[model samples]
Target: MCTWFYAEKATLSPIITKAQQLPLTDTIMNTMARSAAMSGNIRPTDMAAVFAPNKQGNIAVFPMIWGFTVDASPKPLINCRIETADRKPVWKDSWFRRRCVIPASWYYEWGIPPSEVGYHNA
Candidate 1:
């Protein structure tokens, strides 16, 4: 499962502003600063950049906490398998109706060997 994702302000700024035409106001800079404070390792409950549809149905950038809350879990849950997302009660609605994209330069998955991981400077 993907437990963490990376985002850099320098890389995302262009996409957020030039391509998406969104203004990089002070509020957005603050959000970017928070992401940087984590060294781009955005885990569950952290403020992460997400691209989701606004009320106008146009894609917009948002700083969102990166997980879902469920009574079944003691903490927020972050991973949902695509195959089971539509079938699972906790993820069904979000899978079908309220989908959003979490922007990342890359992701980190647990249990993988260092040699096989993306960070390995092979």
Candidate 2:
């Protein structure tokens, strides 16, 4: 049920570049800053840091779209329950092979109780 999160370029690049053992370049830094998504209500085309193996064995941080594309629909599925993923066909392969970690400073939640309405820590 996660629909929002906070991300900062400062954290994302290092997490990826370090994992892949890459030096930070000015171009990538600029791209990270420009594309930084620091909000929870992200859409399908939004980018996030995901890990993938490069030619070498080390994992590299890669920019990936938020969710899978759905045929004949504009909106995509952003969240799924992990408990049932193994039994679901759509996520079975990804659950086993394409597992990843998302670098988030925090997350946002709505409709919480009066004292916790605006935001919550991740």
Candidate 3:
């Protein structure tokens, strides 16, 4: 489950302006600027900010941080099982306090095959 998500530009402008006044580096500032510039116009996937309110009631917008994934760990966490998530250590904190929602027109799910499969075969 996503404990936080980015809001639409109309809802995020004021928050973005406030974030600009903070003591952030040039890169951070630039990214925020870019995100604000693209807000409401681009696909959500292209936005750079994490549009969620923090503990202080302020929006927790931040620059995109990069990470890597390994082929060995192929399965990705696209969704969390809401039923048992609260009991899990990794997601308990976010579930309790920082819960967030991502608005979408539709969502996609894939069906599993009964036999072995590979990228090429699929």
Candidate 4:
């Protein structure tokens, strides 16, 4: 989603620490190091460049073009249902190979009443 997400500083500490340990080429290391210095938190938009994939199935030392979130007329897609992801054209490819985890302390869900039931009281 284009809407900025919240990530706890505590949760990001370990990930940034580990990224620093990665054996990136001098160029890549320099870029990330600079960005990290400027911004206390690493932005996900810059991750593809820092942790790109290589032809040999290894992490590339250089950054690459990362997918960007778009602000469409409709609300941005914040969540995708795992069950229908494969069938959806926009997400099919990324779902298969470019999957990434979103760490969150909490999530939101909506409740809908059963259509068949006229009314139910507890």
lDDT of 3 by residue, 1-122 (tens): 12223235555666545543444424654764443342332332233344557668886655332111235554323356789879976567767886443332222234322221222223
lDDT of 2 by residue, 1-122 (tens): 34655554454557645433333333344664434442344434565666676668677676565676556567777667879988888778788877666776655555431122344344
- TM-scores, all candidates, are 0.66, 0.58, 0.37, 0.40
Highest lDDT, which number? 1
**What residue runs in model 2 are displaced by over 4 Å at the alpha carbon?**
10-13, 16-43, 55-57, 111-122
Q: Quote the lDDT for 24 in model 3.
A: 48
> Pairing residues by index, what is the TM-score of model 4?
0.40
lDDT of 1 by residue, 1-122 (tens): 36766666566765434323334334544664433232246677666657889899999776566678778887888767888999998999878888889777767687442322345532
TM-score, ranked from best to worst: 1, 2, 4, 3
lDDT of 3: 0.43
- Best model number under TM-score: 1
Off by over 4 Å in 4: 23-34, 37-44, 48-83, 104-122
| Cα RMSD to the true fold for all candidates | 5.3, 6.3, 10.5, 11.3
Q: Return whichever of 1 and 3 wins on lDDT.
A: 1
Each candidate: how many clashes? 0, 2, 0, 2
Give the C-alpha lDDT of model 4: 0.43
- For TM-score, candidate 1 versus 2, the one ahead is 1
